[model samples]
Target: MPEFAPIHLLYLALAIVLEIAANVLMKFSAGFTRKLPAMTAIVCALAAFTALSYAIEGIQLSVAYGIWGGVGLIATAILGITLFGERLRPSGWLGLALILGGVVLLKFS
Candidate 1:
């Protein structure tokens, strides 16, 4: 297989951002009761998936998915804590750390 290019990583980054935005919009959707946020969330999620598909064309699926999910989870958790007044337990912090480490390893592998 050909080595991954910088553009693939950029696509992955875009995917991650869009995914996070989708998640936040979904939260604002109030169980899909809010039409605008709910619809926008769906659009953002579809776009994110499209970007992820492009990223996987160059990057290994495992690495691309690992980083995509790990970073998305980490960022969403931070947003939840800050924007939603959510709290994470000590174990949750540890889990986030493990996820970060896994993403780092995947990037270098």
Candidate 2:
């Protein structure tokens, strides 16, 4: 892999954060009935994709996408459970664990 500037990693992290915010906002949007949250979610999702684009300029696309999606999925699921009183079955937890493992493998490979 080519050397990448720290900024690229920062962009990837920012993308993940934005994605999480977008997901939370979308949940609060109540299927887009809530105008403010829905609009904010749209903005956040767009910004997240923009950040991901920037990140891929330096980071490998596979690596960046793996990390972004993996982290976002985990964070969203945790938030859903804690904030929304959502529950995941045993298989769901296993799926998350597998995703985490895949991310780690992708990063190292």
Candidate 3:
């Protein structure tokens, strides 16, 4: 794997945040029926992809995407529980743990 500059890591983190925000906005957009939130989600998704593209330049593509998706899934799950009153089964928690483990393994690999 290539050495990622601090700025690249920052961009990757921001991309993750933007992606999560886009998901939340897309949910609120109600299948893109609402104009403002839908547009915001589009913008967020575009920005997130752009940042993630930059991230892959410094980090390995597979590793960057693994960590990106894994962390995003965990964060989104937590946010869903808090914001939407969603429930997580024991198995769901275990799945989250597995995702974290996969990310760790990807990092070490």
Task: Report the number of the highest-lDDT candidate.
Answer: 2
Q: Please list the C-alpha lDDT of all candidates, in the order they appear.
A: 0.96, 0.97, 0.91
State which candidate, 2 or 3, has the greater lDDT.
Answer: 2
Ranking by TM-score: 2, 1, 3
Q: Model 1 segments beyond 4 Å from truth?
A: 1-3
Ranked candidates, highest lDDT first: 2, 1, 3
Against the correct fold, how does model 3 do in TM-score?
0.94
Residue pairs of candidate 3 with colliding backbone atoms: none
Q: What value of lDDT does candidate 2 attain over all alpha carbons?
A: 0.97
- The residue pairs that clash in candidate 2, if any, are none
Across residues 51-103, which tens digit of lDDT does each residue of candidate 3 receive?
99999888888988998899988998898899889999999999999999999
Question: Candidate 1 or 3, higher TM-score?
Answer: 1
Per-prediction TM-score to the true structure, in the order listed: 0.95, 0.96, 0.94
Which candidate model has the greater TM-score, 2 or 3?
A: 2
